[model samples]
Target chain A: MSGVSEHVVIVGAGQGGLQAAMSLRTEGFTGRISLIGEEPGLPYQRPPLSKAYLKTGAADALTLRPAAFFEKHDITLVTGTRVDSIVRDTGHVLLGSKTLGYDHLILATGTRNLRPPIDGLEHALDLRTLEDAKRLRKELDRPRTCAVIGAGFIGLEFAAVARALGHKVTVAEAAQRPMARAVSSPIAARFAEMHLQMGTRLCFGQAVKEVDETGIHLPDGEKIDADLILLAAGVRPNVELAQAAGLPCDNGIVTDAQLQTADPAISALGDCAVFPDPRTGRLVRLESVQAATDHARTIAKRITHGTATPYAAVPWFWSDQSDLKLQIAGLAFPEDDCIECENGSVLRFDGDALTAAETINNPKVHMKARKILALQAPPGRDTLKRAGYDLTLI
Target chain B: MVKVTYIAHDGTETTLDGAEGDSVMATAISAGLDGIVGECGGSMMCATCHCYVDDAWSDRTGPRKDGEDDMLDCAADDVKDTSRLSCQIKLTAELDGLVVHLPSSQL
Candidate 1:
């Protein structure tokens, strides 16, 4: 380990995987970087798959990096290939039948959409990958009713686009409100109104008992006819390889502050890695581009510059639905107290400390919240209240 | 044509002539405003183009959509009565003198 190791192997060529490769080189590590993914073609951004890409069908805009960038960076991108196993003792990863050795291994396998146990699930379209998005986009070409199973970001986003395309859309949420797990009840209710105003049907607190060609059957026996069904429930980490290889895993592959697994030779990132949250010190998994890229940069710095600083990037996320843009800075638990400003900004607090800030179409506040959270001594609720909750003074 | 004024966080003001039906976000971006990233390209996906409408002209802007109001809930700064997603504010004859204030952060 005196000289920089020459070979680095990264699994999962999504946002984090590709960023790891690029950041490794940017950090001046002249190593043999290999990026592998099970998905076909080059790595692409998944965020747009549920929004713009679905509406415009612009497949080319979804790519994360052009193929030429990888070749120029000396990164070996092994697309359409999956890593079967990791042998920590040998410092090698097995892909199909071939085993490739590496000085350091990175797991950026990301996550897959979770499909609950429901009949005729095959009829439900998924918006996780490019292929799934493409298929769903093709479905939008025809005039048909759409039934979205979940009211999360992706589900609501797709529903908005579908409704804009003049397709009848109905959103079914098992929770009391849309995006109940992610945003506050007030925010969820507001979006409920938006969706309803757009002519998209909202069905809350209804569990889907079954999915059939005709439509979905709710627990109360109400059936909604739909030609297209989207399963936007949520996602699960792709930790099978790590679990099979004897790596510690929970909801996602567990990693330390440095994103390294229990085995020092292996590391994980993106939606696949579950690390401790700096704010609450709770183990959490994030599914945003900001987290993935930030994690990659942290890992790259540790590997190349020997910087062992813990991963403490402030988390933020955004979602687009019709005429509204929702941006969240920081993470708030379900029980966090929310204060609504006169301007409609919601400040979420865990005790006296601000846990997160939720803003719609207001980037200034979103950015301020991120900065405030990153500060050494953020303004407390009292300070914020005294300042008229300006956040600029903070 | 609709006239719009954008006031930066530092109190710098820039005026632009916007076509009718263009979103305030699009008008600002087209006018080369340094702020307003519009990351989601006006789809309301990213709250990068947030702004605060002037109190006098706030009534000219339409009420925020449900999704827009929900997004405003998680903004970094405290939401105010004048806060609005610039993208959702379209240029119209009635909004000729519409003025919006920029927030401190879009990061």
Candidate 2:
């Protein structure tokens, strides 16, 4: 609690874990930093796995830091090692019979693909980790019919790539529109149109009943012949380790504004952290690189500099489908009002206040929207409407 | 192999070797050079990989890739006329000794 927190142990060395290790050094903390990951390699970026890596099959592009870099930073890199449990009272984590002591612990366990109760669901592939992506790429070697369940970001991104690779892709979604939870109706409609034009069959309002040797079947008794079955329905946070340690677990590992868990010695971040939305004060778990890195920075600063500032970085995410780049700045609720912009962008408002902005093939507006949303008081819907929803003018 | 010299904002220099087809950003990143973040992993989504091509080698790096300038607006530092996303600048035999200046920070 005085100088620098000594011996910081970070669990789940993906984006957030690696970032915390690096950030602690950047913040001038010369403590023992150990990053533990279940994966066998150095931490890599997950965003490109469903996009570029699937196409180019370049694994190096996904790696965040090389092996030598870890040595240079003095951060202990442990891969293919799992921490079996967390001993909160003893300030140590248990890995089988071995125990690692820590002045502070960061949980970045992230999430795993949700496996529904569909018969033969084990036959479907996942796209969560680098290993999963590599497997998906191997399946792409041949021209095959692919059945992608769920119409979220991963499913659609994979569908676009499979369709572009000359593979027959049929996307089945239970919702009426694609990406219904993330984007508004207008943007979702546009994406649906884009994928349809590329010859990817879109089956809306259809739930996959089962996955067998013949492919996935709808409850209506429609069977699609798919050689490759992909399950990108969504993900559930990996909270078992924390939950077993007596930490509260809801939709995710519950954390306060500073990303600190119930025990001050422990913290959570990234896909596994359920923190309050900086703007809306609603508990949420976000799965994005921005959230992962920002949360890591905040936690590192607290450990090193002892800064008590709350974690409040603006939330932003992007999905690339073929030639289209869809970027969303800030968060919007399902009940928010949607307004179309002149430059083909879309804005969401919770009453008079601006909630989020969505753009396609427009990073400029997305950047501007992120800056605007980060303000102490973001522009309201009335102000945006007065400016004709032109972010540049504001 | 092509060699690259990356000068940090505070005059720290890091020289690293890159494969013929590797991007300059990929080269610096693989070496853990402090300046370039490449948060998007060379996907061109985030401009955290922003770097300035040395004045002498600006023309050789040539124009920015399509949509590169637009993404630069979100860069941590101000964009320079020689601004180029390091990921977009691929290493080649002809340009073996490329010098790129890194910004103060990338977030």
Best by TM-score: 2
Interface RMSD of 2: 1.5
Which structure among the candidates has the greatest lDDT? 2
**Clash number for every model?**
22, 0
DockQ of 1: 0.06
For candidate 1, the per-residue lDDT at B1 reads 90
Q: Which ten residues in a row have the lowest lDDT in candidate 1 chain A?
A: A60-69
TM-score, A chain, model 2: 0.98
lDDT of 1 by residue, A247-275 (tens): 99999999999888998778899899999
Q: Candidate 2 DockQ category?
A: medium
Q: After superposition, how far is residue A252 of candidate 2 from its true place, in Å?
A: 0.5
Q: At residue A361, what lDDT does model 2 achieve?
A: 89
Question: Candidate 2 — which pairs collide?
Answer: none
Docking class of 1: incorrect
Alpha carbon RMSD to native, model 1:
8.3
